[model samples]
Target: MDIGNRLKTVRQQAQLSQRELAKRSGVTNGFISQVEKNQVSPSIGSLKKLLDGLPMSLAEFFADAAESSSPVVYRLDDQPELGSADISYRLIGSHFPGRAISLLRETMAPGADTGPDLLSHAGQECGVVIQGRLRLTVGEQEFELGPGDGYYFDSTQAHRFVSIGEQELVLISANSPPTF
Candidate 1:
């Protein structure tokens, strides 16, 4: 993909000028201009910082780029798979235009975990356990949730999830600003 063009498209879709984006991203207007013009390549960290300013994740950016222009209905098989084999995340309504939230169907194999590093981002996340058991850790607190149990929290807090039961864990989750 043309990262420069993609960035420009997203930036325009968000209705942000390069100066505004630069200010939000803590980068220089010149840098943003150079990036949009394909005059320079940003390091991964730099690109991530830029994306963060858009309140977007790297995954979301890529997904948005690959998504169809407009899609209202998505079948199970049509959803894009993300993450790894142990913990699969299928995005729902991924092609919806101007989406304010991201919906996901997650399946976690027994002993599967999001990882040791907790996720912290710029939005809010909510999820409900559809089946099996989940161990959720937010900040310093931990909770073991079963089917029908739900959770809501600020995404800024470090959080992680793990499957605790022998059976596979299924969950439906949503996040504002569509992190992934």
Candidate 2:
């Protein structure tokens, strides 16, 4: 793989400068510069440090590089799967063209949750519950949402969700800045 090009692309996509990335990754700016210029090959550990500055995992970085078709219809079965064992997300705009935002159909199994840790990212988010119930905590406020309930808020605030009902909960969620 073209590591230099990949690093450059990921950094640019993240809107991070070499200096900013260096500071965040705890590496020298010269090292980031060298890597981007293809002047040096970084060891896996070093590369991992760079990826950390992007605040993204290696799997996510590579996954975004896998090209997909544009301006096409994505059938239900064609949606990409995201998340882990407790939750599953179906990307809504997988085949849509010029998508400026991301949408998801997320399923949270009964008693499942995103953990106690709150997630904060740059974006605006909105969602509508489709089935069961969910407990949403945004910043210092918390709300219990039943089926057909909805919510909208800034994603920069720390937030988390939990399935509070006996059945699985499904939500249709949308986000600007494409956090997915």
Candidate 3:
């Protein structure tokens, strides 16, 4: 998705200028320009702050970009792919309007990791391992979870996940306040 273009469109739809948004969001206009130009990828916190200026929630922003008609059921191949080369994240109910939760089927290749930097944001996350092993790190604690193991934690805390076993890791995970 072109987040920059989407943000620009949303801002224009709201009839707000870059300067105005920056003032309301308490960020520099340069930052807003960079984001809108796709020169930078804003952090989750930064994105939230930017959205706050428009008085829009993350869910609303995504919902607006989603398909107009939401379906009750999605076949296996119907789900949207949202991950990178090392990971396979297929979003469930991706077309659902005003979705409050993001349910995903996540597959991590062996030795795959979220990134070097920890992830922190609002809301909460939960996941259940369906296959292989995963190394989960939340804050300063870390644990190795096998099949059937589950985890739930506040998203505000820094967290990361890594596939530790030789085999790929497959899991079902959900995040409230949907971070696509």
Candidate 4:
């Protein structure tokens, strides 16, 4: 697979410019340019950073590159978008039958907030902030996190995410019913 081409396609489809993605991904624009041109191969860590801008994962990216149809991989590029007014999430593995869990790649625009509400449900949720900063409100507590910060909590707690900085926020999350 041409990783550079795939990267470029996903970035454009996400409506991101190379500079914008670099800013969100915490990499230099020069580095993004080089990656897109296939002039440099990104380490897994570095590639994960780049994938943040597209709100994707290394598993999802590589899954799409595989040629087999058995076991059915849900390509990141083909994931369906799900969102309310302020926050948007891409649902991963939406088409799978009897999906006991779900994964999502989320993006929140600056100044956007997902309203605070207690969610009473089964299962657990864990997320890693991939870009910008996020203010998470759970029950009576609130916390702020920058890129690479991670959180895991019970789904029964009321929680919401707010973008706290000028840049957009990105997160990779997994939950049951799967969090679409």
Instruction: Give stretches of model 1 more than 4 Å off.
Output: 1-69
Instruction: Show where candidate 3 strays beyond 4 Å.
Output: 1-69
User: Per-residue lDDT for 11-44 in model 3, tens only?
Assistant: 9878899999999999998999999999999988
lDDT (Cα, 0-100) at 25 in candidate 3: 96
TM-scores vs. true structure, each candidate: 0.63, 0.60, 0.62, 0.56
List, residue by residue over 105-157, the lDDT tens digit for candidate 2.
99999998888899899999999999999999999999999988999999999
Weakest lDDT window of 10 consecutive positions for candidate 2: 64-73
The digit string of per-residue lDDT tens for model 1 on 1-180 reads 788888888898889999999999999989998998999998989999999899899999888887735667789887999877798899988767667899999999999999999989999999999999999999999999999999999999999999997999999999998997
RMSD of each: 10.2, 9.2, 12.7, 17.2
TM-score of 2: 0.60
After superposing all C-alphas onto the true structure, candidate 4 shows an RMSD in angstroms of 17.2
The digit string of per-residue lDDT tens for model 4 on 62-136 reads 775463222466677778878877688888777653356888889999998876454556678889999999998
By TM-score, is 2 or 4 better? 2
Stretches > 4 Å off in candidate 4 = 1-72, 116-118
CA lDDT of each prediction against the hidden true structure: 0.91, 0.87, 0.91, 0.82
